[model samples]
Target: MEKQTPTLESSSQPQLKLAYLRPGDMIDVEFASATKVRTKLQLVGFDTGRYLLLKQPNPRTEGSYADVLFEGNPVIVRLVLEGEAGECIAFKTKIRAVTNFPFRLLYLDYPEQVENRALRAQKRVRTHIPVDVTADNNQADNTKKLASGVIVDISSAGCRILFKAQNEGGNVTHMNIKVSIGSGSQKDLLMLSGQVMNQKKERGMISVGVRFTDEEAHIIEVFDHLLIDTEFEC
Candidate 1:
């Protein structure tokens, strides 16, 4: 059975609206079958109002999903939107074709409509605050993967950062967030631990959503600064 989703404007709850998705966006695909197979696919390309083209998952890692990916097979597609628009978008469609000539690809019928659900609990305020993020991949090793970015929007619960990927050769998906509040002698280094919730990469820049863990007290001042800055800007 397919999951029923309400329209964006029909409910006062978190609205799910169609977002302008990019080519490399990652989306989850769930088949409406007995096994109910689910997998992740990258958006290769698409024809507006016609169909969506997705890169088929690697056969070695995903096994051969040939049977489950047949034509006319129903599938549910879900994707997350980070940044200021924090929500999840879902739609139901059927596989139209699968090709493996130049590259393996899965074609899906265009959905008539899509449903979105808000993912953020607290509202976020927009701001630009420089911060350094460090990714500790191995606890036993001393190797540190560091990247510098600015917090674009934030709340007490979570925040979004925009930055250029460092040559450190790994994604800062789950990293420790270090933010500097003041300048010079009065500078306050607020260290907050967080897990990367969602990330989007476009061009050479990346946007990531991070949820703080047990750092409400440390973020109060930062949040207050953002609130005041927002008020001043308005």
Candidate 2:
């Protein structure tokens, strides 16, 4: 896949908060007006400190909010960073421009500052656990496919898994998957459900980051067992 390099802004603004964002990431935009409209839009591109470009909301679905999308309107933007750096970022800016000629697009003034909060309260612990991960394919058929991988590190919130690229194809974001722990008998298998948050592919292998939707108690149980096993072997 060809990665798009975001347009770099001038050096005048040393602290470019929006530089961390990428095209196609979902952003929550709140128009600070009488109606206080809030909606989600996919990021189209950005020019560092100059402007943040976003795909205009679909006319058929989100045309109602067009009234609040005028120039100089105050806007609050937010996006969540998944994977190792789990954080939610928010910034304040204004609608810089809006266009519908060639394409429907919305532009906002580059934020001067950004605020972020950590999503994971607990620190991640490093370990290796053999497992089987079954991810839902992004097709109309809704097939369940399995892959053998190793959970390289984990925390109460999520974990990172390493598996061969041939095991699972394409982007796995938002795909429902189950991490099966243990082996041999059916009773020995401990299944944990989660959605694929992010992935990195290199050297014929892919690293998957997953945030578990299972209860904290269950995660703690697995965490304790893994830790104890590690200590015993040490």
Q: Pick the candidate with the highest lDDT.
A: 2
Residue range 75-180, candidate 1, lDDT tens digits? 8888876657467777778899998999999999988867776676666778787787766444526635366788898777777888885555456566654443
Q: What's the lDDT of the predicted structure labeled candidate 1?
A: 0.71
In model 2, where do residues sit more than 4 Å from their true spots? 1-17, 126-130, 135-143, 148-153, 160-176, 181-221, 228-234
Off by over 4 Å in 1: 1-19, 135-145, 183-185, 225-234
lDDT value for model 2: 0.74
* Best of the candidates, TM-score: 1
lDDT of 2 by residue, 3-108 (tens): 2222223222333346657677779987765544778999999886588899888979767666676898787787876545457777777899999889989999
* TM-score: model 1 vs. ground truth: 0.79
TM-score of every candidate: 0.79, 0.67
Cα distance off (Å), candidate 2, residue 40 = 0.3
